[model samples]
Target: PAPPGEGPSLERFTLAEDELRTVRLRVPEGTSGTELAALCDDLALHDWLLTTVVRMLDGLRLGAGAAQDAGTVVRTLRPAVDHLLHLWMPGARVGRELAALWDPLEERPGFTRQWQVLVQRIRDQLTLHAVPAVHREVDPAPGPPAVLPRE
Candidate 1:
């Protein structure tokens, strides 16, 4: 097997859409397979969530023409609400050694912040197209209309 590449990638996450998702990590030399697998799963989840958010954002661009075809914009964003909203757990499973990797990312250009903004935008867009149910006011019955007699 070839030598492991350069620095501690912390972890490397690769997603090929429908084809594959690969998470490669560098742990201490003697770490057990179970530990490695756990790390990979953790990294993969983060990658998938991040990737999903970017994809969701890509569908949201309501400009001048939005007023005409508003429903389509809302429809485009619903999948992110249904599928990607709950997947954010930053470094939840990462060990102390590599937890630092999440810091720079969580700062300045924050992933979680972007995810929140995207979700909110999706919700707001949908709201823009939603029609509220009309409530009609009716007067109280007046003693069954004085017991109408058959003509």
Candidate 2:
């Protein structure tokens, strides 16, 4: 367990390897070609975003030397913060939400709830938009393809 007053560690934020394997197994065994393609695309996007967030947070924790850095430390934290902002600037509102989530751990002053918020937003966006977009794009047209007329 962490020292009293410290925030949860990045280990808490990680998805177990088994859980990821389970997600892989959930794809239907006999999906149609179009459905299979869409599923693959969605899985790829979901995996990429989740991995990116996890890596960023893990890097931050390592850089901060969370176990050894005295409470309220900030100097080693800037790179992690900058990386997150650069990657997610287009989703600034999401970033703000993340910061709000991480603000309560007074013992670990540099560790913020904002990281959790960022991870959640990225996951939510993947599920809500990226996956659906893949399906829409990969699914076949309802009818025959349109042919352009020669001039």
Candidate 3:
């Protein structure tokens, strides 16, 4: 294979509208089977993650009380937090020949950017829920503190 970026060329296009998203990619002529398979795996992984997160967000009822809503959100998103959050390593396994392919998708659809925003939204929800707990923990003892017999 030619040196990285010298020979291999990648073309990527994405069409995202309403409930449908389509991605098109063209890889250099000499791309190997392993590289092509790896690219497919990478793309499929992102597609699944995107779909899962969108569905999770859609199912959440944002108008519920903070603590209750947070419990629901945590319950809903637990799978993503435990199983999928750490799976965003794009191009980590792709060959040099096809690594450039991700650049176009990143430019057009901003896959990583969207994922980061979604993850942050989850964290913000959890943090917002936690604030009440923290406040309760810090509140002074109710009524009056019993006078301590001389320490």
Candidate 4:
């Protein structure tokens, strides 16, 4: 449970269309149930990766998009990261991997380089997990057609 008086934690970063495209490219398609289960496990790892990166970015006062005060950002994001890791990777190999990544971060003076490294790692993993190529329907019209659907 969180300490009294603290606000709700930050949600994990949302995947944008580009990010989803990257993920689709990495994870193979037509995966069986067992493989899907394994991918779920991998997703846990990926979540932790994102959480850690966000934590570091928060500490540096780098907003996801908008600007925010440094202390407030850290306060909100640190707990969020802790909660996310606890939920996703509790008593598992994901915990070990996070610890390994976090150890160096603890000793680092500034977060800029570390943040870049984390982002690159995530991108690489997303690429690796991308689904195999599949045909996509291309609508000839870029915008809505002149006709409208009947009620």
Candidate 5:
């Protein structure tokens, strides 16, 4: 049941070069406080994760001649990998009805898609950083000799 003239709605906006974002959700009249709180918490966590990752990326010079050192990149992004990456179970605790609230966000901004892309970028950076080390480790030893049997 909607309240008075109010109905379910989700209005989202961004400001400050995507550094600031807001989501206003109007749930049905009978929606429980617990449900609302859970939804808000989930949304807030994701917002923080998105903002933090964006900030981290902005601070990096991935392609510039003065690009960040590999160690610096790892140091900057390690917290996200260790702490935030595993926390993205959106709407997991919300009711089925309320969980549907995430649909619009997913469709328009494609939250999960953006997240996946960002995560991949982080992985690619780390992989690129590791290439030299991997090559060094895999260098053949001086005494490597193998006998080939005739097929």
Candidate 6:
């Protein structure tokens, strides 16, 4: 049962800017704990990527102009790297029936692929900030510079 009025099996909310946004996904009735955990795992992945990663990316992008506030970028995103990134564990706990739910998401849109892109962008931003100013280069290599077009 969904402990006292959780709205619905797939309820969701963004509590605040810093905390992880929540998605109260309820497993189908009679689903095993393992099944529920699997469902939770999927929901968690979606929440972290949608809520945290996107927000961090937006912040990093907006703050990209203020490279001086690299510290702020660090302050804003370090916790996510330290705490949130490791939470992804896709089909681990899902029940057999629920396993199919992840398909369309991983198809053309590619949920994990999108997440990977966001993760790399965030890491790149962090790396850019972490480098000392004198050592930082406009374009790291001699070739045409690669860039992640803003989303």
Q: Which candidate's TM-score is highest?
A: 5
Question: Per-residue lDDT tens digits of candidate 3, residues 1-151?
Answer: 3455565545444446764545455554567888888977888788778778878877876645433555676788788889988999988889887788788668867888989999998777777777877887896878978997996
What lDDT would each prediction earn against the true structure? Answer: 0.62, 0.40, 0.75, 0.41, 0.78, 0.65
Number of colliding residue pairs in each model: 0, 5, 0, 10, 0, 2
Candidate 4: the clashing residue pairs are 24-130, 24-131, 25-130, 26-127, 26-128, 26-129, 26-130, 27-129, 27-130, 27-131
Clashes of 4: 10
TM-score of candidate 5 on Cα atoms, chains taken together: 0.81
* Off by more than 4 A, model 6: 1-41, 61-64, 133-151
Better of 3 and 4 by lDDT: 3
Cα deviation of 93 in candidate 3 (Å)? 1.4
Where does candidate 2 stray beyond 4 Å?
1-31, 62-116, 119-151
Query: What would the per-residue lDDT of candidate 1 be over residues 7-96, giving only the tens digit for each residue?
Result: 334444454768487645555555566655665677567666767766765666675564435556656766777777777787778666
Which of the two, 3 or 6, has more lDDT?
3
Q: TM-score for candidate 6, please give it.
A: 0.57
**47 Cα displacement, candidate 5 (Å):** 0.9
Q: Estimate each model's TM-score.
A: 0.56, 0.28, 0.75, 0.28, 0.81, 0.57
Models, CA RMSD each: 8.8, 22.6, 4.5, 20.7, 3.2, 11.0
Candidate 5 on 12-122: residue-level lDDT in tens? 535466465566777787888887788778877877777788788778889657657889988988888998888877778777767877887788787788888889998
- What local lDDT score does residue 144 receive in model 1, on the 0 to 100 scale? 58
What's the distance in Å from true for residue 80, model 5? 1.2
Put down candidate 6 lDDT per residue, 1-151, tens digits, no spaces.
5555332244343356777444445544555777666676676667555567787767654554555477787888888799878766666567666675565456745668877887887788788777865476554678886898998
Deviation from truth (RMSD, Å), model 5: 3.2
lDDT of 5 at 92: 84
- Candidate 4 deviant stretches above 4 angstroms: 1-17, 21-32, 44-52, 55-73, 86-151
lDDT of 2 by residue, 36-94 (tens): 34433443444454456666545443332345232222333344455544443212232
